[model samples]
Every structure is written in structure tokens, then in C-alpha cells.
Target: MKIPERYQPKNNKSFASYWQPTKDNLLPFLLPKTNISDSEKLVPYYFKVDDLADEVAVEYFTNTPFNQAIAKLHTDFSLFPSNKNRLSLATQNLFQQLNEVPSWVDFDLVNLGTSYCNRTGTAALSVLRNYCLMGGYESSAINKPLIFTQALHKGAVKRLADTVDFWMYVTEINGLKPNNKGIYAVLTTRLIHAYSRIQIEKKSEWKSELWGRPINLWDMLATNLGFSIAFIDGLSKLKFKPTAKELEAVLHLWKYVGYLMGIPLHLLPNTGEEAAKQLFLWSKSQKGIDTDSKQLAWALYDEPLRVTFTKNKIMKWFVQKTNLGYNEVLLGTESRQELALPYSKAKYWILFLNKINEYFDTKAKSNPDYYNKIAKQGRKAQEKVWKLYQQAK
Candidate 1:
């Protein structure tokens, strides 16, 4: 098999390391069963971009109406751009995909997933920020796109604020439905990624031969899995028990979301085991944490103090300590030190937090009414923080 220039690994050593099989993946049930040769076969996927969206990006610059057609999707997805903008076949094809609902999607299950996420509340955010997003910094190449775009200029706090808004929109009830902002956001993000690829390629520093297309399908799948399977891993460590159905729904929900974002449905995981397999395969070529990873980690770590949700110094200080406590427990000392996270005895806070969460979580599970109440409360708390994010400078 010929290794394409686009598929080349930034670190030759990591590329070699990737070909060797590792039994470790994630979770007790979701661990991947790998054959030693698995990584060798899938090496090219790392360089693959969303061709449809990339075409849209190419045509989008030449055809401004295509942009308008895309924005129209926020209000009504049915208005296919084919007739309106003389869109290229690629753009029209993307519009059609967005309009058609995949047969596998179960709205009830998707909502159930949303409710589960809602019920978990701040704990869910904790895993997403500290573990999934923060811990994801371990990748040297996958994060290069962010660094190339000067993401640090906006700072991690604003970036986190933007991310929260996007997550809330996508997880909102019936949010992914046609004509909803959730669908719109996903589509827009797809285009943004494509556009970013174009912009970054023009820069001299971007090494397409080593890093592949920006936000490639491989990278997108990695991120989507972070939200689904890896997210569950973090939540599990928090001692939050999600029912089997909740687990299934979360995977299904993210699968559809990933599909809309132009990730291949085949590549998206149908189950946790499938997710772990995909995760393990893609992770083979990734390099360990570098300067970019450390910078991003520290930014996220300090975000609690910068966010405007609470101006009270004492409360903000306590929240930072709590987050550190979370990082200490979830990320372990080795990872913590690599990212230069400050030391904290506050890691013990997990005991108290888990004890309280477990008690209430248990009560809610046994009583439907109580579960509904907490779901409502959880969503409210999230919205309040979202509002604060919006107000921040």
C-alpha cells in the first residue's frame, strides 16, 4: 500500500508506534479487539477531508449566494440551493443530505439522550471540559489547525463560551430537527471547517504533507467520539450511572450529529464497542502532548476565573479549585504535570461531590417525577451559565 503525502504522520516515531496493536482502548465493555495489522490498513483515512463540504467551500468563495442559501437553512432546510444559486452539484448534494433524515435516527431516543445529558448537568460539563476537551490536548497534530488559526488570540475562555453555546444548541430538544438552529449550527460548522482548510493551506507554515486536511474526517470522528464514548468514560469515573438505553441514545444522537457535520455514517459508531474501535484505530498516529497541548490545557484550566458567569472572587476561586480537583482525579498526575496544571489537594473534593450526586441521582432514578424535576433544573442551570457566557467580554 502506498502512503500518500497527505496521509504522512508529522512524527515518524508516532506513526511507527501506531502500527503496533494495543489492547487498551476505553471502558470495560467498549474495549476494542484489535488485530496487529489493523492500523496499517486504515492509514489513509487520516488525510481524508469532507469532499462534499470542501467543494462547497471552493464554490462558496466564488458564489456568494451559496452563503445565503446556507444561512436560509437556519429557518428552513427544505429550500434546496440548487434552484436558487445555481449551486454546484456538490453544494446541492450537501443540501439534499441535510434535508433527508437518515432512517436510523430515533427522535425519542435522541431526546432521551438530551434529557440524560441535562440530568447530569454540571458533571457533564466537567467531563466535557476537563477530560474530553482538555485532555484531548494530548494530540500534537490534531490541534495544529487551532494553533495555525491563532485560536489562542481568542483565548480558551471565549472558545469555551462558544463551544458551550454550540453544545447547548445541538442538545436542545428537537434541536437537530430540520428548521432548527441545531441543524443550522452543524451545517455552518461543516462549512467553517472546510473554509478553515482553505485558509490554512494558503499559509506557508501549514504542512499538508504531514498534518493532512484541516478538520479532516478522521479529526471530526475523533472529536465526535470525544462527545459520545469518551464522554461516557469520564462520566463513569464520576460514578454517574447511565442506563443502557441512555448510553445507546447518546451514541445514536451523536452519530446523527456527526453525519450532519459531514462525517461518514459508516465511520460513526453504532455502539460503544464500535466507538472504542474507531477511537483506537485513529489514535495510533497521534503524537503525545506538545507545546500546543500544554497551552490549550492551561487556558482551559484558567477559564473558570476568566468567565463572567460569576464575578464573586470567592466563588470563582472555589470553582477553579474544584475543576483542578476534577483534573487531578480524571487526568491523573502524569497528565496533569505534562500540561503544567498547578498542584492542588482539592482533588479530595470529588469524594464529597460524588457522594451528594450519587444520593440525588439514585433518588431521581427511582422516581420519575423527581427525575423530571432535576432534568428541568439541570437545563435551567445550563441556560443561566449560557446567558452569562453571552454577556462576557
Candidate 2:
């Protein structure tokens, strides 16, 4: 929801100065459902072979190889990507924690999924499996929760498409109308960025001129869709039975993404890297544009500048191209609201269980004491459920 500009922090203040949760801000700290229990019966959801992903994501917050590194950078994005060595180290740390998975995989999909929980929903069964390809993991460590056997054929690309669909859902829920071309525009922008990142990383090419070009709005919209849907999935899970700590962890992670995505500091979404200092500064300066819609509009307007840092001359080129981009928006766009909903099957329950443990493992390692307290009780409760399932098995 949008708020008036008068109440927001302006004058180019840091996000740290304005990042507080208020009733109508971007991401309010969500309270968990009161009726949660580990013993509740689970439904089924299945996995597919076409995606061929790991059984589950590595618990970067727990286990060996990368926990410490992740712990170090968990809240600090600046230091992690500071240099090639640091990036390598950060990637290595993640690799070890994640059973030696590729770095691109970590950032592109898995972390993106974790980030979704922060943006749209809480980190729960279907949510995690949907993001990290839980059915692909090899360990039982990934399979300690509710198991489903229904088929779900989704991938990173499909996730990108669904993100667009989810955003349409949220806007409808809020009684607001969506931009007809918004989702497609956003998706297109994301594709460009994704492609750019790949080319830059693989070819070691850095064109200063390219940096200033206005983002293909379609691609950026898709990126936002990815974020919002993930957040929605994570949040809806909270509406179901979830632990207090899980709620807290999910809340914490959500803030992180909100901040990174230039969410208003006062919106109360969640925290992100302190390195986002400049972006947050811009957000603070626009505090005058308050309501959720206005704030979102203002933020969206600021996106191109953020995409090209002030140091990049190309930003000027992008600014000049704004008219071209604006004209494109006038074209008729598709309304995803009418699209048929994707089916949720029974086999997915297995993948869902695996994801829950994966989420727990990451949360536990990130905050051992917190996870331990819950683990003691959770383990016992889990064993009881396991015995019951075995009997059925």
C-alpha cells in the first residue's frame, strides 16, 4: 500500500535512517499462525525429472564448507562482492556449504528462492522446493518433513513467468489494477540483466557505455515478479502453522531483500546489505512520495539511475532514452490475471518435506542457538511423525 510523502524520510538520508516497519510500509513483520505443530498430516506434491536439479539446496547456514563464509556475508553484501578474490572466496564458501554446487546456480536460483521467502512469503515446504529444486538433492537430511507425490513442472525460467502471475494475484488481492504490460516488461528487463551478468562474468567484458542504457522495463518487471511471488509464498506459509523462530528468520530474510530491491526503509519489509547505502539514500530522498503506489512508482522511476551508478556516463544515455521506453509502455499488454492457475499435485509432498529440512538446516546454522532450542523439540516431534509414516509406508 502507498502512503503520503510527508511522513517518509527525504533529504537523501541513508536507508539506515529510515528503514523501520510501520503499519502500511513495504514489508511489515508478520506474526505467525497460532495453531502450528510438527505432527500435522501432510498432503502430496511430486517432483519432475525434466528440471533435473539437486534433491534440495545445501544448508549454507549449517554444515561444513560454506557456513562460516555465508555467516560472514549473510548480512553483508558489500564485502562479499568487493573484489575477484572476495567474490571467489564468497563463492567458495557458498560452494562448500552447498555440496560444491556451481556459483551461478547458488545466486541465480537457490538464493533467489530464499530471497523470495523474504519478498512474498515465508520459507516453507512448497516454497523452498519450488525455488531450489529440492527433489534433486541426494540426502535424507533434505527429506525430514511432509512428503507429497504430485507433479510440478517448474524451473528458473518458469519461476520467472510465474512471478509475473503472482504479482497480478497480489494486486488483485489488494483491489488494485495492474499495468497491462507490466509483467512482460519486467520479465524482459530481467532477461537482459541476466544475460548481461552472464556475458560479463564469462567474457570479462565491461562496457561503460552499456551501463547507462535504461533497463528494458520488461526485464526489470520480471525480476520484481520473481521477488514478489517468492515473498508471497513465504508469507502465506506463515498464515499456516509455523514456529515463532521460523517466522522471525523469515522476517529477517525478507527485510534483507526489500532493502536490496530499493524498498523504502520505513516500509518494514526486511533488511538487506548495508552496502545498499546509496540506493537507500535515494529512497530516503523520495520520502515525499508516500503511499504504497506512489512510493512504488517513485522507486520504479529511480530504477534506471540505480542500475547505472552515478559514476557511469552511460546513465546519461539511458536518461535520454526514457521517451523510447515510455512509448513502448503505451503498447497494449497482456493481462496475466486471466491465465489458468498451475496445478499442484500430490507427489510434491516429498519435495516439500525435503525443502522444509533444507530451510531448517540453513536457518539453524545461521543461528545455531535459535535453531537448537527449536531443534530439540522439533526432532522429537519429527521422529513421532516419521514412525507414523513408516507404518503407512
Candidate 3:
């Protein structure tokens, strides 16, 4: 499909400002029924997996001994040419693909993005947990058997930890390098998705669906927007306003992340307004929330509370109250009703008071110390949650 002219980024200050979303700008965040015809048209560009399945590529990735060798070479670049001739043709091809970073990457912007994330601290985690994860589940395409079984049904705390790890790795500079842990983690995930598509398509259940593939280009783009656009929106609703540059840097950071995750570049938005347009398009393309979506949403909402609020009644009460307010305000009333979550006046007031505290805290002290304290607390909490998950199993 040809890119819309208005969605294209313009080279002017007016065109570059942070998008202010109005009521009219807000799209109905419902999943749409899949259109087979539309899916077919996008398959070649968006869901191409031939490269991943190439005989040589598959052998290199699948062979345990060869994978060990590649890991050694990856950790110590000095070991590359030593096994250069011993390496299979497939291994060579895979190596090149792994090293290929997008030409558009701006290191300065990447650093700025890191700083922006640092400034946001634990608040970013709240946005990610409450908004992005919940919003992702709202997509029926994403809530299908493959993902639902592999992720949502597999303990929420584990799922949340895995997601947090991804965000942390992607934003860190060391994680962006070729053959690094972050790149490997993302590529491994992409391969898993491709494998899931192949396996799921053969099933009677998936074949009956309008879209043939389990994860398509539209779904990938929507998921990307959840991390970028939806995350920023969540932060804004929480009263944590980022500077224009910080916003752009964060989007740019995720743009590179999308590129690494195998999303087609053309589908990614260059500006917040363009992102909003793309999100609206995605929402219009989906059927409304399904049973799977509701199941996943409820799990996502309740599991974190269950794990985090094991003790400290007052703290647990505050967190749950604030979370309810965050969901109601950010997810919209329709989504709240759809998820069967009730509005709590106490929660709304709790959120208001917390926002006031956040503002005053910022005004009273430099944020580095505050950010450090929050990060420390978050780390401890995540570790405890991880331990609990392990214990339950």
C-alpha cells in the first residue's frame, strides 16, 4: 500500500511538535475482524519469512554444536576468521544478517532516549505494565492461540518480567550491538513467532480464521505502537510530561527496535501524529475484543497486584487504587466496561494525590536520586516476584 501523504513527516518545526490528542483524535481501541483480502495484500512485504527458513540459515541456527561455536565468536570477535572456513555457508549468511544494523540509526538520539527512560524511572514500568500489556491483549489477533498459550496463560509475573527485560535490554547501549544479548533475544523471539506461524497455520482452528498467519505485519506494527505511542500516552495521562526531544528520541529508539524485530520500515511512523494515524488504522482493521482478550486483560491487571501486594496493606491499597484510576482514564470507559472493571472514586483520588506528590517531589529535589531510589525498589520487587513465580512452580 502507498503511504499516505499526510502521514509522511514534514520538514518543519510545526510538523515536528508533540502531538496533542483531542477527543476526535482518539480512535476506538477495539479489535476489528480480520479481512483476508487485506492480509493477503500485505503478506509479501510484512510477513516474509523465506530468509529465516533458508536451508543454510535453519541448519546454522538449529545445530547445537554450531550454535555454541557462533556464541563463542559472538562474544569474542577475534574468534571469527579462525572458524571462518569451518563455518557452513548458512552460518556465514546468518552472521551477516545479525551484524546488519539499520543505516538510519543515530547514536546521539539513542543516548538521549536512554536518558529519557532513566528520568522516567519506575513510572515507565507502571505505564508498560498497565497500558502497553493490557492494550496489547485487547488485540484479538495477538490474543490468539499461539500467543495466548505461550504467554498470557503462562503465569503473568513471568510474562511481565520477560517484557521488562526486553525493554531494559533494548534501551541500553550495550544491548544494541550486533551479536549482543539483546539482539540475540529479539532475533530468537522473531524466529519463535515465525515457527509459531508455520505450526499454527496448519491447525484447524487457525485455518478457520480470516487471516492465515498467526502474527502478520499489521499485528507487528500495532504491537510496536503499543510500546511507543501507547507508552507515551500513558505517561502523559499520569502527568509525567516529557520534552519534545525526549519524545522524539523515545520514538526513534523504538523505531530501531522495530527494525531489529523484523517489522517493515515503511509501516513505522516517523512522528507522533503519524503514529496516531497508524494506530487508528490498526484499530479499524481489527474486530472488537474477544474472549481471549478479556481473559488476558484481567490476568494482566490482577496478577501484578496479587504478586506485589502480598503484604503492606496500605501500600497495596494505594497501588491498586492508583492502577484502577490509570486504567480507567487511559483505557477509556468503553474498555473499562468491556473488561468488567468498575470505577473507584477512592482510586481516582489516590491517583490525583500521587500525581501531586510526584510534581512536588520533582520540584523539591534533583530527579537522579529519586530515580535511583525507585529503580532500587523496583529491582527488589521484581526479584521477589520472580522468586514467588519460581516457588509456585
Which predicted model would earn the best lDDT? 1
lDDT of candidate 3 at residue 217, scale 0 to 100: 62
CA RMSD for every model?
4.1, 22.4, 7.6
lDDT string for model 2 (1-393, tens) is 222222233333212212334322222233222221210111000111101001111222224443353344333322333443644443344323322222222223322333233222222223332321211111111111101110122112233234333333222211111222332222222233333333332332332222211122211222232233333322333232323433344344333333222233343333222212322322233322112222222232333343322446575445424412321111101100111111223224433543664565556546647554544544344334334323322
Regions of model 2 farther than 4 Å from truth:
1-125, 128-240, 243-248, 261-338, 341-370, 373-393
The digit string of per-residue lDDT tens for model 1 on 132-167 reads: 787778777788899988888788887777678788
**Better model by lDDT, 1 or 2?**
1
What TM-score quantifies how close candidate 3 is to the native fold? 0.73
lDDT of 3 at 102: 61
Candidates ranked by lDDT: 1, 3, 2
TM-score of 2: 0.24
Model 3, CA-based lDDT: 0.59
